[model samples]
Target: MKVTDIVDKLGLTVFSGHEGLGREVTGGYTSDLLSDVMGHAAAGSVWVTIQTHRNVTAIASLKDISAVIITCGEQPGEDTMAQSNEEGVPFLGTTLSTYELTGRLYSLIS
Candidate 1:
């Protein structure tokens, strides 16, 4: 599924990086640790996390992720949004907890 498809399916909010809406989502990865995500997350995966720092966008770009989803209604940092837009990685938002969002995404993509 594409980022746009996942957003529609999960009722996620698109906060930035509109250019990457067509990016394909191969799977989902849920984590708050930057190192864990950097070492484990696969390219084309939608990353679910509570982290909203600018480093999140850096890691997303480095890993070639499809999108970043901020869970539990946490707002992303200004630099994070700017970097996301610059990198063309969609920055999404959700009110659901990390577990709930991961479960929903797993069912949709698996």
Candidate 2:
């Protein structure tokens, strides 16, 4: 599935990096721990996290993540948004909790 498809399917908000909406989403990783994500998230995966810090973007980019979904009605930090755009990694938002988001995403992508 494409990032855009997930956004449309889940009613997610696109906070930044619209350019990456076309990117393919092969899988997903749900975590707030930077090191865990950095070490485990696969390339082209959509990362489901509550973290909004700029470092999330750096890790997402370094790990070749397809997108970052900020859950629980949270918003990304300004620097995070900027870095997301710069790295062409879509920064998405949602009001649902991580579990809800992950369940929905899994049903769609799995």
Candidate 3:
């Protein structure tokens, strides 16, 4: 499925990086640790996290992540949004907690 599909299915807010909504969703990774994500997240995967900083986008871009879903009603900073737009990595948001959102995403993609 594409990033847009997840956005539609999960009612995710498109915070930025609209250009990458067509990017394929190959898998998912849920983590708040930057190093963990960099070590384990696969390319084209959706990342579920509460992190709202620019480094999240940096890691997502470095790892070729399809999208970053900020959960628990959190919002990304302006720098993060700009980085996401510049990197073409979809930055999404949801009111759901990380656990709930990850469950839904796993069900949707798997």
Best by lDDT: 3
Number of residue pairs clashing in candidate 3, backbone atoms closer than 3 angstroms, sequence gap of 3 or more or interchain: 0
Candidate 2, 1-110: lDDT as tens digits: 89999999999999999989999999999999999998898999999999999999999899999999999999998888898899999999999999999999998998
Query: Candidate 1 lDDT (Cα, whole model)?
Result: 0.93
- lDDT by residue (1-110, candidate 1, tens digit) is 79999999999999999999999899889999999999999999999999998999999999999999999999898888898889998999999999999999999999
The C-alpha TM-scores of every prediction are 0.98, 0.98, 0.98
Q: How much is 10 displaced in model 2, in angstroms? A: 0.1
RMSD of each: 0.6, 0.6, 0.5
The per-candidate count of clashes, in order, stands at 0, 0, 0
Scored against the true structure, residue 67 in model 3 reaches a CA lDDT of 96
Clashing pairs in 1: none
Candidate 2 least-lDDT 10 residues: 77-86
Q: Sorted on lDDT, highest at the top, how do the candidates line up?
A: 3, 2, 1
Which residue pairs does candidate 2 place in steric collision?
Answer: none
Model 1 earns a TM-score of 0.98
